[model samples]
Target: MYAVFKRELMGLLNSLMAYITIGVFLLATGLLLWFFPDTSILEYGYAELTGFFSLAPFLFMFLIPAITMRSFAEERREGTYVLLAIRPVTDWQIILAKYFACLVLVVFALIPTLIYYYTIYQLGLPQGNIDGGAVTGSYIGLLLLGSAFVAVGIFTSSLSKNQVVAFALSVFICFIAYSGFDAVSQLFVLSYFETVFLSLSVNEHYQSISRGVLDTRDLIYFITFVALFLIATKAVTGGRKW
Candidate 1:
């Protein structure tokens, strides 16, 4: 798993995908938070990243899929999956190694945002009037949300050999998982099942946790969502050999 993890990470860095993802995330966040004078968070009265966090998940709709589209699709396209299959590694390990590699990239992409915290801190009206607990909670929520999206992307990537198809499917799945249920629940036809559907939606839990409440139910929802997709990927890959 470690070897696979390292290899995957090295590949991302070698191709500069990791750098590009992080750079884009930072550039977008920076522009939203500081650069654009009219829409900048600094112009707003809120000290916390209410604007930043609210905008990020939507941006990640594209960015996370872009980062994860190649995870297994590229392997299958290059015919390296067979080589991986002949190795001693279990499918679980292979899935996890890829998942962890993507997670590492997500964390790497997020770490640079700490600078935004510092900037906000220094610029706060009372020298850090920001809610520390709320910021921490939001960051945790963001990580969980990203993890679930990564798992979804990986599963979608595993379903296709073409990276473009994988990317498109990933984005569609991510967007739907994140917001589809919320949209569906609003429709009159689904009104009877509205409560049930909303509960199943990713955005519901994300919004709950984003409020800085740290609800265990919301966290469990994210963990289970990620695990479910990972398991589905494993089942799909296993079926390929059978």
Candidate 2:
């Protein structure tokens, strides 16, 4: 497992795609947080990172899929998945290795955003008047959201040999998991089950955590969400004779 994990992580870090993904995420978020009038914190005249926290998941929706699309898809397309399957690692290990590798790339993309936090901290009217707790909580929530998305991407990548198909499927599933349920709940016809539908959205739990409250229910939901997709990926991969 350690060997697989190392190999997977190194492979991602070594790839030009990984850097491009990180660069794009940073560049886009930077623009949204500091330049884009509508979402820009500077325009809001507030020392809060609310703009960033709110906009990041949307970026993750596309960024994570790009990172994970080739995890299994390329391997299978290139006839290397069979070679990998014969390795000493178990199916779960392989899935997790790829998942974590993609997640770490996501983390690398997020790390640079701390500069925004620092800027906000310093820009606070009283100097450091920013809501540190809320910022911390938002970062935690974002990480969990990214983890769940990574699992979804990994599962989708396993389902197709073509990277484009995997990428598109992952983005669609990530969008639905994150916001589709909430959108459905808002429909007049679904009013009776609005709570149930909202509960199923990644947005709901993410919002709960973003408020700086460490709710166990929200934490559990994220864990369960990630686990389900990882297990599904394992199942999909296991079905193959390789």
What CA root-mean-square deviation does each model show from the true structure? 1.7, 1.2
Model 2: per-residue Cα lDDT over 101-176, one tens digit each: 8888889898889999999999999999899999999999999999999999999999999999999999999999
Whole-model Cα lDDT per candidate? 0.87, 0.91
- Model 2 per-residue lDDT at 139: 99
> In candidate 1, which residue ranges exceed 4 Å CA deviation?
188-192
Task: Tell me each candidate's TM-score.
Answer: 0.95, 0.97
C-alpha lDDT (0 to 100) for residue 130 of candidate 1: 84
Off by over 4 Å in 2: 188-191
What's the residue-level lDDT of 191 in candidate 2?
62
